[model samples]
Target: MATSKSVLFVCLGNICRSPIAEAVFRKQATDKGVANDWRIDSAATSTYEIGNPPDHRGLACMKRHAVPMRHVARQVTQDDFQSYDYMLCMDESNLSDLNKKASKVKNCKAKVELLGSYDPQKVLIIRDPYYGSDQDFETVYEQCVRCCNAFLEANS
Candidate 1:
């Protein structure tokens, strides 16, 4: 059996950007026949949206692309710091928040970094679309596809 690799996608509220990233990566990995090698999930940097479903706009966008996504908002935990192989976040604020949280954990082994760091186009941030229109969600989806594809290729 192949060894398992895990990733935790994170964002401000986990209702918008992170879920999109998680779904995109999952789909790409599945397409490449590596889905069984991954343990993918998404989380929030804050408790503001804990237990909430992903934002409706993001859900619609994922459906449009035929990328299956179903997730409840959850905050990053100490266990996550030790568990996931990579903890990829959306923006600078998320990077800072996750690094801060990881520092508080007893022994964090995950490589925490910006998901956009993998984007070939150098679009270094995936902005939240929570308060924006459907167009904003589409932008997030596009960026996620670009970044997630690069990330999967690099890691493969």
Candidate 2:
């Protein structure tokens, strides 16, 4: 492995889970005073929400919990596989999508991982909050916060 320290969080849409993971990871790193040690980003599996701001609910959820991060939705790019050290997915479907893309990559260096992989004792998938109630968003946010914090602990 390269000594590079960067991570790319991915999900079905950039509107929700991935952005939360990105922000959560960023926040955790900052809290640990290791924010300068890593570069973090997020992307979507599909183009549906590309060029759009993160979903309102996603933002509200973060705001409610006070996990600050703002980003526009974007689709995963070929260049990301080369630029990032790790590519983390929110769930199995997104992981499969990323894998399909990675299979076509030449000299791929990025390690694809599930966001929950950071949570050694409870490897649960981060649930999607797009179609749910505010309470659901809170639940998802809480889970991502925990997983993201764990990621920082293990990696930093």
Candidate 3:
């Protein structure tokens, strides 16, 4: 049997890109019959929108793509750096923030990197759609799908 892996998806806020990526990754793993082999979740670098559900546009985008997503917004914790096998963030800012936070935690095991780093299409940053239109939300979803699939492939 394969050993389980864990990942924490992170963004500026948990309401948009990260949640969509978390959902897309989870569903992809499930469809590939490997959901039980992973621990997947999402969080924000800051406390903004703590306890809030994903943005409405994100929710709708996931629904339209038939991907299920339900998560309360949360800030990344020091313990997260010690637990998750990977800390995948949406952009350069989040990468910097998480790296700074991880540096403060002894024995931080998570490999912090941009989620878009896994994108086969070469998109290196997953932009926030909070101020954009539905098309922006759809774009996030599409990017997550591509990146998540590639991540699963690489890890599997």
Candidate 1, after superposition: displacement of residue 34 in Å? 0.3
TM-scores, in order shown?
0.97, 0.93, 0.97
Q: Write the per-residue lDDT of candidate 1 for residues 40-114, one digit (tens) a residue.
A: 999999999999999988999999999999999999999999989999999999999998888888889899999
Give the Å error, residue 86, model 1: 0.4
Per-residue accuracy of model 3 over 1-156 as CA lDDT, tens digit each: 654899999999899999999999999999999999999999999997999999999999999989999999999998999999999999999999998898899999999999899999999998899999999999999999999999999999
* Candidate 1 clashing pairs, residues 3+ apart or interchain: none
- Per-residue lDDT tens digits for candidate 2, residues 64-128, read 76789789999998889878889989888999999999999887789999988776558578888
**Candidates 1 and 2 compared by lDDT, better number:** 1
- Better-scoring candidate (TM-score), 2 or 3: 3
In order, the Cα lDDT scores of the candidates are 0.93, 0.85, 0.94
Candidate 2 lDDT trough over 10 residues, lowest sum: 1-10
lDDT at residue 139 of model 2 (Cα atoms): 74
Candidate 2's displacement at residue 59, Å, is: 1.0
Kindly give the stretch of ten consecutive residues in candidate 1 with the minimal lDDT sum. 1-10
Ranking by TM-score: 3, 1, 2
Model 2 ranges off by over 4 Å: 1-4, 120-123
Off by over 4 Å in 1: none
